[model samples]
Target: MTNVVLFSGFGSHGKDVNEDLFDRCPDLDSAAADILGYSIRDRLRADRGAGPLDSPSNQVAAFVVNAMKYHAHREDGLTPDIVMGRDLGEYNALEAAGVLDFGTGLRLVHLRAELVGNADGAMAAVLGLTPEEIRAVLRSAGLHGLVFTSLNTPYQSVLSGRPSDIARAEEILLRAGAYDVRPIAMGKPFHSPLLAAAAEKFRDALRGTTFGRPRIPVIANCTALPYRQEITAEVLARHMREPVRWHESIRWVADRFPQAVYTAVGDQRLLLKMLRQIFAESIGPGPTGATSRSPVRIPSY
Candidate 1:
């Protein structure tokens, strides 16, 4: 029975895990305060009260929530065999698997947002269109700055590029029969080359940090493979300017662990929702002979 623990990226956090966690897990709460130089709980509250959280708020909240949840799950005797994270969520995954300590992870998260700053480009989700379709739309428009960044699910993909180009692409996609093309509220055009400077700085930060091998296996978002420890930092830094191959990452997990039960411990069940979509078709051995990923025994409990 493989237990794959999932953590989501920025912009997905809500008021899911907050003040309640301080009392439930005092140790974690204290650690957060000690490392962050203030109470993360207080930050969460203030950030929420301020209305929609910015990129920094979402990043902080996502990590804090997942870290607390990981510890709580441990106390409940639920240790993961594999830890996987999506996009920015990989920072917490590294911490969960012991590749990085709490202090390093939290500080890195903060630094990541700081370095990326506010992006000049924009990101938008084009639902009901495969990544391939979205790319075709961009190409037809002869847009060079805009690029597909995240493949969230088979049918949903996120694109990041110039705001004007994004607006133009939205119109084109809608006309092409896209179910919905909504803008994602983010300060950074994550996973896009526009942040090349930020990515380089992030790589410098990564080089300075010590990345040990994970106690529990951790699947990386960029390569959809286990972190090489020594090169994991490079992969993480590249993620800033490259696409998050999420669909492939999930497929990699399912193919390896047929009885895998994916448990999402983050802002919400974003990863699980994507997982269900990936497993939607009862994929199995076809008439050709070999089996594709499907009929997964994802426990419903």
Candidate 2:
């Protein structure tokens, strides 16, 4: 059987990778850079000479996607059977699957970051609480501002809201029998309506961009389904303001690709670690006869 490899590209980390790969593979780098430059220049002309800050997030995504494609093509030789991503990583996965072209995906990513950056609230990771239980606690506490950002696993979830709302939700979860409620280091509440403006801006931007069917399957964060031909920039735009169905996405992957080897292609290995915990029994001893550490770095093929 052909070994299936999964690649979830990096977020901010991809910026550096783009530079590094440019030095190693000039032709690939040039091709990727040309695409990125065209995207930026077009944006500038449309906006009437706005600087990078006006659309920094999309610019970053464009750069990252180019770099990721370069790396994947250079190392893997052929596209993998499946690709997935979480939060910002989803854009990278979309690029890999050929759903969103490099420029468009990058543009969305840029909007996502800026929108997320504008929020002044906080987020936290709550462990040992089922989704039902957490929802019950939120309801009981009357915490109106809180949003569940990630369904990471059966017992682990990430919550986002105003600082006070988050604190209240945390207390309620702990009081309702959660094992741990810890704050995440991230400064903003993502996957919430708090970034509605950003999502709207992205929607406008998407009006001009085009999308094609994917060459490989892409698991979407909002729907947790394979990318369909019907998927439009409008649907992707809404994903910006919707919570990530991470648990469902993972279950989809596990159910569909039982024999595939999963790898998280980003700076943080948290996604891989979570996958191991969720599918501990499914994973077997490798050639080294040991459980693997997550966040496997993609090497040059």
lDDT of 2: 0.64
Superposed by TM-score, candidate 2 places the C-alpha of residue 127 at a distance from the truth, in angstroms, of: 1.8
* Model 1 / residue 189 / CA error / Å: 0.6
- Candidate 1, residues 1-301, lDDT tens digits: the string is 8788888787756565546666877877787777667776776677667776767756876777778777777777777888888888888888989999877888899888888775687899888888778778778879877887888778988898888988898889999879999998773688889988899989998988888888988888777888877887898898788888888887787778876666777644566567767666323431122352232222211
Q: Which stretches of candidate 2 lie over 4 Å from their true place?
A: 1-22, 25-66, 69-74, 281-301
lDDT of 2 by residue, 1-301 (tens): 2223344422333333434444555554455457446442234234443433233444364446444554556475544677777776777776766776655665566556666666677889999888788888888788867888878777888888898888778778888899999997655767778778878877787787777787878878888888776766766776877888877887786666555655456543466566765665333332222553222334442
lDDT of 1: 0.77
Report clash pairs, candidate 1: none
Instruction: Give the alpha-carbon lDDT of every model.
Output: 0.77, 0.64
**Candidate number with greatest lDDT:** 1
Predicted structure 2: clash tally: 5
**Deviation in Å, model 2, residue 158 alpha carbon:** 1.0
Candidate 2 accuracy as TM-score: 0.76
